[model samples]
Target: MAVTGISANRLELLQIANAVAQEKNIDREIVIEALEEAIQKGAKSRYGAHHDIRARIDPKTGELALTRHVTIVEDDWMPEDELEEFNDSAMVRLTDASKRDPEAVVGKEYVEDLPPFEFGRVQTQMARQVITGKVREAERANQYEEFKDRVGEIVNGTVKRVEYGNTIVDLGRGEGIMRRDQSIPREVFNIGDRIRTYIYDVRPEAKGPQIMLSRAHPGFMAKLFAQEVPEVYDGVIEIRAAARDAGSRAKMAVLSNDSSIDPVGACVGMRGSRVQAVVAELQGEKIDIIQWNPDEPTFIVNALAPAEVSKVVLDEEADRVEVVVPDEQLSLAIGRRGQNVRLASQLTGWQIDIITESQDSERRQREFSERTTLFQEALDVDEVIAQLLVTEGFATVEDLAFVDNYEVAEIEGFDEDTAEELQARARDFLERQAAILDAKRVELGVEDGVMAVPGVTGAIAVALGEGGVKTVEDLADLATDEIRGGYEMKNGERVKVPGVLESFNLAQEDAELLILQARVAAGWIDASELPQPPEPEYEEEGELAEGEYDPEAVFEDVAPEAAADDAEVAEGDLEPTRDA
Candidate 1:
């Protein structure tokens, strides 16, 4: 039989605890507590199962103590019926406990000392198991704390083991795992291979800390450049943005604090040394080091380097850009599979629509004709007046109706009187359009609950009604992803379907508010000062409950002015109360 391996002298327990803590890289207090619990487990095994055995290890001298503890309780606190079944070993009444020690009080613990027992095989084995389990738990906790905040940082490690495609890297203090998908495309790992990776996430699992590593993440490329290029590390060169397509290609935009040093060249190094190093590490992935400019168009031009842009049109409100490039450079600007323009879009943080010069010219003419047709039919104007209105950027009747008097007067041939006359016509046209939409909404059976959604226009409400979400509860039931294009099965395979909001081209923030309003309307959510749905109709003893819901009564709490404010197209001072 195996004998206990613990030292004979009790004072050596403290020395053993300190060594275990150092070896596990955990706290000494935690190790000492583990030792005490391990010893207590052994005492419990040696003593009877119901005995209240305890153990303590002194922090200073490391002296060991063992005892049987019982708690003193007031008998008056117990119920009268079950007092006979009270546990004598676990608890003693204050009256009985005070005879042993006159100072004994309720809630105080009384201890009886026990002689130290020999470490038999069973008791020693139980203690060893308890110590191992507790120490392992403390080590896991300490490891999680050490590396949880080190996410997005570059860490170097040696491949301790490779299981299939996954790599377990020994990162000095603790092991970090690099999953197969997180690695750069086609990159292979081997046991004993040294690797550097970016810490992407540190998920705390029930068992222990899960350190997720990634080389394909955009931050990895940025950190690599920072390591290779001195200027970037020192803040002389700032990396404005970075985008990665993994081991295929990557783009980095850099700006220089010193006017003399070209940021692009500084990152490129002497004859392509600095970037080439990063490229080799990334398995020959190409890197584009572009000079950064604060001007958006200028930045876009730099980002799309080697491709000349002829013209650029920006729709700021829409967060979109139309870039017109020379016809010959069209294919070059839009690289293999549109990679160049795609990276430029990511680097610029804009939705880019790249078009050839001829394509843009054609689109402009098409838009002008469409706007001209809209103005002619809506305002009952002649072709000449309609063309002029279209040329002045009055795309919709609502735009013309809401224009400042001075704005329309500034349009080439229109005076203040003509502007006012045009404005009045526009407002009249919109009111008629609104009336038509109201009739259409009724035809579609859109509920008042759908209409009350803040950002939902008449067209959006119609779309929702036609899509079979005609009630407030129906709209509220939709998930955010469902409202912003979600996956569905089509032709026996999963595919993404366009959402109702996609057809209306509603802003994301507006879509969120509409959902919130729908939830509020359905009584699923509450907002301060906003309308709330009526209480559920419960049947009373003598009276029957109302069978149908009336939204007017449901939203009776909403202010009349607030309801009218959202219904009107224009807000506050801009509302067209009169003919204009």
Candidate 2:
């Protein structure tokens, strides 16, 4: 603070620089540079604004030097800044300088030392302001450098203050902010109270680096467990996934590398000591430590614990799982306000739809009735024959039309002749349906080129035309979300936007394939440039034994022939034919 004038004692200047640097936790060299700039600005005011004044401070002795510079330039030289006109005090023309000194050349600087002067009131204030601003900038830079790489770390601090529900934390070296949304609900921190937070993010801004802190973050809980559980900290156990409905409940999935160690029990500890420590830090929030399973369905079932899942049906293509529980457990499975299912979905990375056993049975019966009715009407068969076909998993007319005659003939109480007759009727019905859909597509202004796309059938063409995508180019321009239905925010509410192919029940990948094929047919891309499906990864042998549960067996229940039938049906309800 003894920066009264450039003529101040040399030791006093160094002492001031050292004090400010130490107090602000910045480099001494930075403080000296700041002082030099302040002196330069004061000198400019004292001499003349047009003069090129420079100041330097010797680091060891803190000796101040002030000088005026005049640079020799070409006769036709233009100022680098267009707004700055030529200054005779700062620059001398090369020809004029050559006349004054025979050896004078362009780019040469002439320096003249000036006597130092004491600071006047106005100059002292200006110097103080400049030094303060520069020192503040240095301090910000140092703080950013210190904390930027410390993200994802848990740190302890004191509550500095609160503004509008946001708590400012006073870290030992830098400050951090815990926004209201990032704090546990009902938690309060008065000034000077001790607190702990996770550094989720650190961002540099015009004001300063924003050190973002959070107590509600899943990482905060994970790190606290790591700190309390020696196995977690030592990497013997790993926290695979964590989901939180902060201050109410949380679900954590943990796995162990060592086969003998039970990850869940280890995390629970004796008498719930380990988990209790973490729960205490989290304001007594309930924590469910479940063992992680490599199988997604099993993991999801584990995630929905204490409710007891009766069954889980997975649609891997859509990354959705349907869970059926007992009627008594419906509310428990869904939790209060759907919190249990929401946290389970988050922890397992799947969309879950929970249904009671009665609902599942009702849905199954409805689907069977619908399929039986379709077969009965399409094949002109009796209720017995239609019910038999529906029971055999013949989902659509297209399936019966394309299935091998031998497979149908092998059915109970059926022969080759009956199988041949049923398939003939099935094909005839598909042909008639295709004709009707084709006529509708034409009426809707669908182009022939759209039918040429590899995956497009008459039914899909009609649907696309009805959706105002009549041409292949139009289909090519559409996004997958437009083909597969999705929700969109409209007027502060989420509204369902029906897809052009939503009725077809196409998987996300199937919708993507339709667009890619359209793009190829429309000359937007070459078929050769299309992405090839990845080759199946080869797992290690000797992994599975007889009667063992294989995660991949979820899809194995559907026979290969039935799967193909269902896949073809999903492509389009109508049979494949070259004729549009």
Candidate 3:
């Protein structure tokens, strides 16, 4: 094989390049290009940085050519100060060039063949680095291009080794990493163990290709079911959503287009054989096949199966569900370490709060009593009218006041006169409440920009003021979640203080818009400007900064006043309570 040697041995260089290209699975031309670069680099180092030198490899016969050239100049083309820095070989007068090449003209150049360079230790090392670097780069490029399209596919490989608790798998084409957390919990694998993993991500890195593999990923389970069940593979049964705890339990919500086919049963297969196969592969992770339902309440009930949900109440505005079950089934519904409810929440994409039947009844009664009392106090009505109002979906004075008179007249037992009277009273009560809230807002020193925010009703403004959100600047600094619900700091914990959501009944969208408006008002972002791309992720080092790098560290000494605008609120802080 030809190596990167002198002219006699240069004929074999093409053989060396071919061997490298085959071994690295790269183009043979790429190897030749690397060799040319390496030779040129060695020549430059042996000569000088300013010398114009080039090396080329013969494509057919593996011959080598090394050349140095100089332009024959009629006049100086550069400034005198810069001209002094130019090398003598860079340009020569036609008179002097004729001494070397008698046919050389003013516009033309003189060329000389360079002698074969002896490969010195340092020069050889540099050449090797250049060649190796180009080869590795080409290999990484091949790896990236080969696997980028394979993401989300189940791949088969053999476990190569374990390092830092992560398993490295040698796929036939490339290597992949299964992060410890991405692997099934407590599942062990030895070197040479055959493994099937979900290629969840393919990221290009400075070092090489990063093929992220996962056995615990929900996609893995879904792919397994697809592979094991022909119905799923053929698209008879569609997997809607999947949630997994990895080696413990998983829930897969599926739907079938054909009315005759039962999606869950199809996924379960004959006597659970198919699911058991997936389970064995997952190290005994129990699988739940659930039928997808269009109705969210029905879906919630289905997701909380086995324990049998008795009732499901959804707060669509909050995207939260309250599920009530039999008292004995509470633990079962919640599962060990709340795994069942957690996976259920993930499957349904709604925050799930599990409660017992008895607790549900108590909560209903408490809400009923609170609304009734609020109606009686705010409208100056009797308990009968209050009860009617509560039963008719009038939860607050704001609700009654903001409602149209026709809506009030729609009450079963109420006539137009009575509706008008009730509405007048409700309006008056709201005006009084607003005046009080305005005073409190002013007294508490709320900023106008925060108050002007759409979701910051007079009462919510009072709450924000009390929470130290005193300026538009403060509001702008808050996260979108903070604007919706205030958070609180207690015992060095976030504690998730409620914000405008409860007080103003703001939706998540409302919070986002309100925060955006605040950002514009406080000059955080322009009203017409689109949000900028987020900064890239960076690693943090403790020794890099002398002090104050820890985000949570500041929370240790944070006083009530130091809490950010969206950063402080105890539960129910934003809930309206009528007090002068």
Candidate 4:
């Protein structure tokens, strides 16, 4: 056999493999494997043989060779049996035997020298197809491996194509997908446009590497700052948190490990160059860079940039903050449709409730006036009468309502008849007030029901009267059990108190609710202080017999008519004294 065509010597093949590896930035071994596979396929197709074949290359010399595999069989076996043993199914057995002892096996694999035959036109075309296909597959796999670890890094890419508003980016070695949802609103991209995006994700697919890139992610802002400011990438400054409304506004909270470095100033850059670069990338999306603080109020104030905060009322328990701004700056602080406050809340991880000075002042005044009106209404008196009662140590309506008519009349310059009239009027007024409260309950959509008996005690009644608990229905809804359970302080210390609900004679439900309200108003109890109530004991026999009721009084003497009449006269005399 004679050789034909260009002879690819060992040195030439090594040079070719090295060049391919360098150009594609792939391993030399991978390229060599690809080339050997291509040559084996081409040789098989040219020879038109149906046998197992594999190819290998010498690492030192880059010498490529192909071997055909056959199975071992007995010498006495028939030609048909030998052919069957040498078929594809028995190739592995033959190869194993050849590895152990090449001379002992008759149908085992052997180094056969084939002629360096010239290929026909069709065979040459087939060889070219195989080589090209293998090279392409290896290149794709190499590219995927290179880019998989590069996720979350910033990359500059050129727009290769646009389909359904998605920008296909040419990242040199591979392609990246920039979906419409990952882009900022109102931002446009054209074919061949060069842009910078963050590699948000990387996934391997059958076709090639799938790189998901984005510009709208909150982390993208932090990454941009890191690129622009050296302090952020180093240990000096750290981006604590970031929030974005994409295209409209964004907020970032940063902290500095080094005391000398100002986190905000570092991110801002000299003359605003660092932040300006980020803004330019975002199509001028507004960014408010603030210093992260352990104090929530200070952090929130900083988050709401371009607006000065007069005061911050923090509700630490609820994770809420009420920001008080000047009357003139209310709109500025709140921004268009509350965007500023909303972004600030997101940045600080706290619910921000914005209020103006005028609004807060008006709210306080209204609450004070309502308290005064409630006191007067509760005492069943006019404003003047209520004021006088207050001056006489009856500060609350409960105090005045519980006082007797004789005691009211004993005050200086108060006539007896006038006092009686006033007492009657006060009782009538109490009834009317109760009716009004019931009406208010109806108006406010409270459930209609009878008040429970257990919820009506002196202290509870007073609390109810002060808190506008005028109706029996209100008493039934209170939670007496919780108030009875008491509460604990922030220091984990238990508070000593009679039941808040029991004082008002509230029923189980009413007492519990009232206690909850008290806890809310006073801020004395955490959620852990509440206790579950025990199940009530049920009585089977509802009533006691007359004989059974008198076990302790079984030997007492009964009174006669003359004695009873005398007793009644004495009681009547005593009633007049109480009345006077």
For each candidate, the alpha-carbon lDDT, in order, equals 0.78, 0.87, 0.79, 0.66
Instruction: For residues 320-386, write the lDDT of model 2, one tens digit per residue.
Output: 8888899999999999999999999999999999999888777777777788789989998765667
The residue-by-residue lDDT of candidate 3 on 1-580, one tens digit each, is 2234555565578778888999999999999999988888888888886777888888778788898877777645554785465467677776777788878887785567899868778778888999999999999999999999999899999999999889999997789999999998788899999999999999999999999999989999999999999989999999999999988899999999899998888888899888889998989888888888877777777888778876666776788988879999999999999998999999999999999977866776777778778888888766666766666666678788778888876765565667777788888988898899998888998866677765567867887787788888787777766655657779988887666445666776666777787788877787787355469989775462321122212112221221212221123231122222
**Which model is ahead, 2 or 4, in terms of lDDT?**
2
Separate clash counts for every candidate: 0, 0, 12, 21
lDDT of 4 by residue, 1-580 (tens): 1112224577776777788788877778877776676666666776555755666778788666666655566534444554454343334453456567756556545555444445566656665666556666787787778888887789999999989989899999888998999999998888899988889888887787788999988888889888889998885899999998888899999999999888889889889999999999898999988888876667777888789877677765457778778988888999998899888888888898888877776765454345446656654444444333333444344444567877765644344554565556556666776777666555544333222333333333544455555555454444554444455565687766555334544345554555554454334556456565679989696564321221222112221222123111122121111112
Residue 128 in model 4: lDDT: 63
**TM-score, model 1 to reference:** 0.80
Best by lDDT: 2
| lDDT-best of 3 and 4 | 3
TM-score of each: 0.80, 0.86, 0.79, 0.52
Give the alpha carbon lDDT tens digit for every residue of 223-315 in model 1.
999999999999999998988888887889999999998999999999999999999989999998888877677777777876888656666
Residue 549's C-alpha lDDT in candidate 2?
Answer: 39
> lDDT score of model 1?
0.78
Ranking by lDDT, best first?
Answer: 2, 3, 1, 4
- Cα error of candidate 4 at position 311, Å: 7.8
